[model samples]
Target: MSAHTWGSLDDASARALMEEALAAATGEGVTFADVRLVEAEEERLYTDLRGELDERREHNAGLGVRVLRNGIWGFASAPVDGAGSAAAVARRAVAVAGASTGTAPVRLAPREPTSGTWSVPVDVDPFEVPAGERHDLLQRIVTAASAPGLVRSVTAGLNAKRQHKHYADSEGSRQSQHLVESGAMLLAVAADERGAQRRSFPNSFHGNTAAAGWEYVLGLGLEDEATRVGEEAVALLGAPQAPGGTADVVIGPAQLALQIHESVGHALELDRILGDETNYAGRSWVQPEDIGTLRYGSPAMTIAADPTMPGTRGSFAFDDEGTPASRHLLVEDGILRDVLSSRDAVARHGGGAGSGSDWPGAARADGWAWLPVCFATNVYLEPGEGSLDELLDRMGDGYYADDNRTWSIDDRRMAFQFGTEAAWEVKNGKRGRLLRGFSYGGLTPQFWGSLEAVAGPEEFKAYGMPCGKGEPKQWGFLGHGASPSLFRGLSTGVAR
Candidate 1:
C-alpha cells in the first residue's frame, strides 16, 4: 500500500499556530495558558461469520486553548485553520475564564520550562499496511472461529490510530508528540438449550491496545487463538456452573488488569479522593489521610503509577500539562503511599499545600477539545518471584480465572463483583476442567489482603483500555500491567 499523510498542517505550521495562540492568551493577562494543535486519524475494520464486513476511517484536526484567569479556568477549541482561528480560540478561552466562578485561584505545582519531541517507535505503521491485507487478516480469524454448527456466530476486528500534537504554553514549554495505537478483538458465540455462551481472545473490551504499531496486533496471535476461543465458547454451553463458597483462586493477568483499574488505580487518583470527580465519576473510598497510613494490601503487593514504560498506551514523555513523565509508587509493600495526581489536584490534597511528589505526571486530556484532568497512567502490580505454575502448585486446589466477562463496583470503589469469560478447576495443583459462569466478590481492601502469591515478570503483561471520567465525559486510554495472582479464600459463585 502507498503511504499517506493525514494532517492538514505540517509540524512547523502547527507550531507557529500554537505560538501565536499562546501569545494572544498571555497578552490578555491570563496567569496561565496553553495551546495545542492535534491532528489524529483512526482506521477500524470488522468481519463477521457471514462474510459481512464493516470498515471505518476518520481524520480530525483541531486547535484548543486553555487559560486561567482570576483562579478559574476556561477552555475553547476550533477547527485548525490559520492565525485567525488560533487567536479567536485564545480570546474566547480568556473571556470564559474571566466570567467563571471560583472561591480560590488555581495553584499549580512548580515545573521548569521544558521542550522536546517524542514519538512511538514502530516497525510498521498500521496505517501503512494494505487495506486488503488488514481485511483478510480479520476475515481469516473470524472464519477460524466459525466452528461449524457448534459456534453460532463469530466476529473479529482490528483498529489503529495515529495522532500528532504540537503544544506550547506561556511558561515557555514547547513540545511535540506523535502516537500510534493498535489493537484487535475476536469473539465466538455458541448456543444450547441452556443459553448462549461467548468467548473472547486476548481480552473482552476491544482486545488489548498498546502504544505500538501493527506489530502489537500481530504479536497477539489472534489467528492462532481464534480456534481455541471458539471451542471454549462451545464447551461453556455444557460446563458446570462455577462452585459457590470460599476457595483460593488464581487471578489471571487480564482480569487482574481491570481489578487493578477499578479498585486500585481509580481509587487512588488524587482528584477522586479529593471529590473533584464525585459529581460525575464518583469519589474514592480512600481519603487524603489514608496515604502513608492505610494498608492497601498484603506485603506481596506493590503497585506504581508508571507513565515511563515504553510501548504501553499510557507511556508519554510528558503529560498534557508539560509535566515530565515519571514513575512513582502508589502502594509500597501493601502500604498506601501516593496517588495518581496532577499539578492542580495535588494542591487540593488537604487544606494545606500538597507536595509536588504527589503528582506523577498524570495530567492528560481525552483530545484537543477536552481539558486536561487527573487520570491514571500505567498503574501496575509489581511482579513477584514465582511463575503461574508455581503459584498454582502453591495453591494446591482451587480455581483459575481470566479475561473479564462482567464487573460491578460501588460508587465508593470499595465492594465489587467480577465474572470471568473462562475459568478452570484446579485439582492437585493442576488445571482440570473448565467451569462456566465463574464469579467472585469482595471488599476492596479485604480482597487485596488475601493475596498469597504473584507470578514473576515472565508472566507480567500490560493491557490497555479506554476509561471514562469527567462531567461532559472523556475517554483516556490507560494501561494496567499485572500477572497471575494467588488469593486465599475468595467468595465465588455463578452470576445467576
Candidate 2:
C-alpha cells in the first residue's frame, strides 16, 4: 500500500456538509434523513492473443440524500460542489417526497445507532501500480494461454476499484469506510471444423473478485493456470456429450457457488418476497409466511448470509444504510429461517425476518447515485463432513461438473437450467472419461432437497461476481461459498 492515508468524513469540511444536509432535511419536518458522501474510481484493462490492449476508467464523487416525509421516502443526489450542495440536495429530496401522496407510510425496524470506521486490509493498493504494469499482467495471461494451432484465441482482463464513503443519519449514526477490490481472469478458445470450445480460469464471468487488493490478483496465479485452461479448451472439442437422464451428480465449488447465488440468494431477498420488486425484478417464490416453516431443502442443507466474513466482496463494516454488519442463517436444517431483509422490510413484516436479534444487514446500493435496496451478500451452503473424493465415492456413478458456462432461471428464481464447461464420467466410484455439454434442470426447492453430501471445510471456497437487479439496474457484488457437493436424481441433459 502507498504511504497515503485515505480521508474520512470526520474531517472538517465533510462533517460540516453532512450536518448541514441533515439539518436541512429535518428542518423540513422529515422524520428521517441520511447523507452519503462518496468518492470512487474503477479501472479495467483488457488484452488478447494478438498483443492488443484496451482500457476503461471511471471516477465519481457525489453526495446523495434520502429523507422520510409524511411516511414516504424520497431521494436526491448530485455532484459534490461545495458547502451549499448538500443542503440543496436535502431540500430537493424533501420536495421529491412530497410528490408521493397515496402510498402507506414506511416504518423502519429499530436498530441501535452505531459510530465507527472500517476498511479492507490490503497488502498493496491496486491504484498505486502503474498502468503499464497492469497491462503487462493481462498480456502475460493471454500469452501463456496462446497456442497458435490448437488454442485459436486467448483473452484476459483485470478489474480494480476503490471507494471512500461517509454516512451520517438523523438518528445519530455516523461512520466512514474505505474499500478496495481487485481480480483478473483468463479465457482460451479452441476451435476447428468441429466447432469452438472454451475454458476459463477461476470463473467465466468476473474471476473471483473480493474486498481485497493487488495481492488478490497475484493469488489468482492466472499465468500459471493459463496453460491448463488452454489445454482444457482443446480437449473439450473432442470430449463425448453428457447423456440425458435422471442421475446423481457431483458439483464442484466453482459451479455450486453460482447455483447457490441464482436459486437461493435472489430467491430469499425480503424486498422481492414483499412484492416491492414485482414490476421490475420478479417477486420471489418464497412468501412472507414461509419463514421458519417452509421445508427448503434436505435436513443436511444449511445456508447463511454473512457480510462480516473477512476479505469477501460483500464484506463491509456497515451497509449503505449505516446498519452494522451481521451474520445470520437464512436456512437451517432444511427449513427457511430468514430472508435478506432491509430495515423497512423487516418492520413491514412486523419483525418476522429472523428470530430474536438478527437484523439481516443486507441492504446496499451500487453507488452514491442509487437508492439502497435489499441485496445478497455472502450467501453460502454450510459445509458437511467428507472430502470431495469421498463425496464422489458415495455417489458411485454420475457426472462430475465444474465451471459455469450458461444459466437460465425463471423470474421467480425457480425452475432453472445451468450448463457447465466441463464434466467427467464417474463409473463405480472412480472418475473415468471426460464429458462435455453437461446441463441440469430442477425447481429451486427440489434442487436443494436432492443434496446428498457436502465436502468438509477443507474443500470450501468462495466465489464472487456481479449480480444485476432493480428497475434502474444496479449491479451488486455478490459472494457464494460452497464445497464439492453431491445431488441425487437431478434431470440431466446435453446442452450441445
Candidate 3:
C-alpha cells in the first residue's frame, strides 16, 4: 500500500474512501455505520508586554469510523492512507461494538439523505499570510495596550484554523465541507493595594471567533481598541466598590452572551435533561415534562438555535451525523418550546408536545476523533423593540455592567453568580461614576423573567468561544448573539 496525504486528496477520492469503509462495516453485519475523514491546519501567534512570546503551526489528517452492532456503539480512528486502511478501521469499530452491551436498543429518527458541498466565504486565507505580517499585527496590539503607565502587562494573540471534511454514512448521505475561522484578543492588567483589575476587548474567554479569514481579524480594530482597554483597567484600580442592594441592572452584549451560554444554552441540551450528561455537566432543571408548559422567561425573551447564520462560529451546512442544519426556536414568547438534541435523543424522547415537527439539527463533534454529541450551535436571544438609551431611561436607577470577569453556576444550572470588569451607576437616566467589583446572582428562571427590555437590532452583536463539555471533554467552537438588555430588581453587590 502506498501512503497518501489526506489533505491533498480531492473530494471525490475522499468520499470514495469513506464509502468503502461504510461498505466494509455493513459486510461485517453492522446495523449502521458512518465514516468521517478530516484534514485540518492551524496557526497561532502570541505576544505580551515583552513582545512575541510564541508561534505555533500544526497539520492533522485522520479518519474515524462509528459502528452500531447489537444496539451498542463503537468508534475508532486512525491516520488514513487509502481504501484498505479505511476498511480496516471500520472492521475494528464493528468488532468493538459487537462485544459491548447496551441497556436499550438504539434507534435514529428519520432523516432524508443529503449530498452537497459548502465553504465559508473568505477574502484572504490566514495560512497564506506571511508569518512576519502576523507577528507584526500582534506586536502593534501589545504596544498600544502597554502604552498606559498604570498597566502592569498586556497580552495579545491571533488564532486561525482551516478544516476540510468528507462524511459518508450507510444511509446514503455523502457531503463535503471546507471551513475557515479567525480570531484575535487583547487583555490589559493593572494592580494596586486594593486588587488587580483587567479589561479585555471583544470578549473575555479566548476572544471572538468567526467563520471567515484574515479579513475578520482586520475588521476587529484591535489596535484602535487596545488603549481604551488599558485605560479602563487603570481606571478600575481607583473606582469605589459597587454598592450592595437590590436594583435594576443592564447587561451589555458581551457579558449577556456568556450569561445566555451558561444559564440557558447548557440547560436546554436534551442529553443533560435526560441524564446522559449528569456526571460531567450535571442534570438540567428542565425536565422532559416541562417542555411545553414551562415558563422560561419574560415575554421579551426569545432564544433561537440557528446554524444557518452567516459568519458565525457554529455555522455549518450539516452536522457530523449528516443532519442538515436549520434554524429552530428553543424559547418563544418566554415559553419553553424546544431543546438541542441529536437524532438518537429525538428518537428516544419524541419532540415534546407543542414542539415543531422539524428535527433540531445540532449533533456535532470537536473533530473526526470524537463522537458526535448534542451541542449548542449559534444560540442567540432575538433583539427587542428598544435601544440601550431607552432601556437606561426606563431603569430610573441601576447599574450597567459589561465584560465578564468571573462567573459561577451550580450543577443544575439554576443558581448562578457573575462578576463584571466594569460597571457604572445609572442616576436620573444617565451613567454616573464607575464602580468596581460589581456582581449579581439569582435563580435562572427568575433572573430571565426579570428581563424587561432589550436593545434593538442596531445594538445587537454576537461573540464566539470554544465551549467545553462531554466526558472526555470535547471543546467545540460556538456562537451566541445578544443585545444590551435590562433586568429589574436583581441581587447586586461586590464580589465576596
Off by over 4 Å in 3: 1-6, 27-29, 351-357
lDDT per residue for candidate 2 within 337-440, as digits (tens), equals 88887888888887454533457778888888989998898899999998888988899999899999999998899889999999999988889988889999
Q: What is the per-residue lDDT of model 3 for residues 208-288, given as tens digits with 9 covering 90 to 100?
A: 888998899999999999989998899999999998889999999999998999999899988888899998889899999
Cand. 3 Cα-lDDT: 0.86
Per-prediction backbone clash count: 1, 0, 0
TM-score of candidate 3 relative to the true fold: 0.96
Clashes of 3: 0
* Every model's TM-score: 0.97, 0.96, 0.96
